[model samples]
Target: MKKENIKKVVLAYSGGLDTSIIIPWLKENYNNCEVVAVSGDVGQGTELDGLEEKAKATGASKLYVLDLKKDFVENYIFPTLKFGAKYEDYLLGTSFARPCIAKALADIAIKEGADAICHGCTGKGNDQVRFELTLKALCPDMAIIAPWREWDIKSRDEEIDYAEAHHIPLKINRETNYSKDKNLWHLSHEGLDLESPANEPQYNHPGFLELGVSPEQAPDTPTYVTIHFEKGVPTAVDGKEMGAVELVEYLNKLGGENGIGLLDIVENRLVGMKSRGVYETPGGAILYKAINVLETITLDKESAHLKEQLAQKYADIVYNGQWFTPLREALDAFANSLAKTVTGDVKLKLYKGNMINAGVTSPFTLYDEQTASFGEDEDYNQADAAGFINLFGLSIKERAKLSKSWPKIED
Candidate 1:
């Protein structure tokens, strides 16, 4: 849509550097149009402080801070967990949060009678696709604006310069401007030294690893805890029931303290480029593993195998920003069905970035002690294995017989 047609625009604002500068950039470029800023809060603590006053001071007419943390965990995180989805061990932290944030932007746009929904996602990243696709899905005719693709400002330094000229108060400067995304599930760090694949992460750098310490700096003693799950969703820790937000927060603290979930990888982005990023997903790491440990005895061989295959596909769907599509809904349904049997308790020992399975128990466990016992029993028939082996190996035996005439065994 043309700039003249956009009398009002709703921006998917996060009080971050990219978005903080974007509020001013949109006004200067869009005929000084009415900018309504929507900050979808999914538990990025302290980031939302003084957001409304800041938004207005920066050129936004109004600000809407949507509290989606509980919704994000219950609706997005747990479903992905039940599906056992992981984008190359990433835990779908930033991947899944985009849709949640975009949905809020779309809703606020419609409510405010806005002509366009703008976002601060860059042209080079996956979030641009995630946010735009979701906004388009939810609001088909609403115009979408991505300032990074349209703006003349080429770099973060330029953005800071622009912000300073406009007198926009910012929490960061050019030196500390690492492109980051934080939410209830994880905190992702990109750019800066993390842009290089060969560089080792400064896990011990002060204030670098915001969530917690490195494994080397973690406490020596192990922390053991049992997580209770109902229908594949984590409900409690150490037998104490908690709400979705509380559960994740509690686990995040524990997992962070133990240096449990720090991932450094050069992942294949949806934009057909490899981007190196460091992720801190303390609680999410524990949740994913806990479900895997529970599913060990709860799910049967066929279901488990099929779910694993589907999980790979699901991970791709999420990573590619297809969250609101029918395919995602279908996969979620399949995951929900399989997860029905995934209710159980998983006991794990956390120590220095290691999660060791201590114990697992479920009422629906398929494991039978009697059937798996090594001792001889009156009901067991050892001689029956000969016929079973013959039937099972029939195809291999016939293939060998057919190939015998083709080549000598010695050759």
Candidate 2:
């Protein structure tokens, strides 16, 4: 990578410490290659305000704030949710959003005719792998530059000092020490005391939460709500149709009030180290629960079982940053097939941080009242179980008899 030939470079800027410092660092190291800052608005509310102006102040030639919220929720979040994929029992909300953001950044780099695309992701985290992998999959010809891997600055303290010395305006306070990532789906908090798994997370620690009330602070009264779905995508709340963004926002308000979604886990990063993170996903949790409730009625037994197994694998694949692989696409096809019939209404009871299924109804429901009832008439016979059980257990019964005859003394 020759500095003299490099005319322009695109940077994945978050308006944070690392990225703010990287703009100047790129100029200092790359002989002042024109830096274009690209920020993706996946759902980080007001954090993006004045980003373009701020980028200019930081010595960027221009700034692109791409609004990918609709695409993010529709294309990435919903598809993963339809698979019921949860990485280690916590939804891969963050993992699912990364690739799409990277894609947006790469797309900007190509359209702007930048010579290279750079990212401020740390060396030890998963985002670097996710970002670089997207470039490899989508725009392989583009030069990839990762500042964390190449920069001389080694610590957050050093980066913060650089930002201060260079007059880069990043919001930092003594009260706010945790690193946070926020989008429309959820918010994730890591670093500081969270680096140690033994420490019980301090809610009093600033910036440790988003979108939900603490479980302890949740009201004792239960909140009941109905969520309607069409082809596995949530369409309404309480019988009113809404857009993807509105539906999620509605659910977030309801779920947060009742303390619905919060997760703390020590998860494996793509770089091969375990990191502790706390996530707040109030709306996503409600939607996942409501969708599963609908699927219970809609999906056939075999399809439901298979999809459950596939969900875990899907979660693993996404968590490992394999979003662009063929296997994930194939799995997505299967999930879509199963999701086609997942249309219905689900009523959930939210109380004390729990999402409880209250009622479910779907047009494609496979549940048969006659077969499942205790007072079933012609649909079933009591005598049929005798033969069926005997036939099914024949091999097991023979094996047990042989085992009895060949039994050895146990200690």
* Range of the 10 consecutive residues with the lowest summed lDDT in candidate 2: 201-210
- Count of steric clashes across candidates, in order: 0, 0
What is the overall TM-score of model 1 with all chains considered together? 0.97
Candidate 2 C-alpha lDDT tens digits along 120-148:
88888888887888788988988888888
Off by over 4 Å in 2: 204-207, 404-411
* Candidate 1: segments with Cα more than 4 A from true spot: 378-380, 407-411
Worst 10 residues of 1 by lDDT: 371-380
Deviation (Å) of 326 in candidate 1 = 1.3
Model 1, range 189-216, lDDT digits (tens) per residue?
A: 9998888898998999898888878999
Give the local distance difference test score of model 1.
Answer: 0.90
* Residue 348 shift from truth in candidate 1, angstroms: 0.3
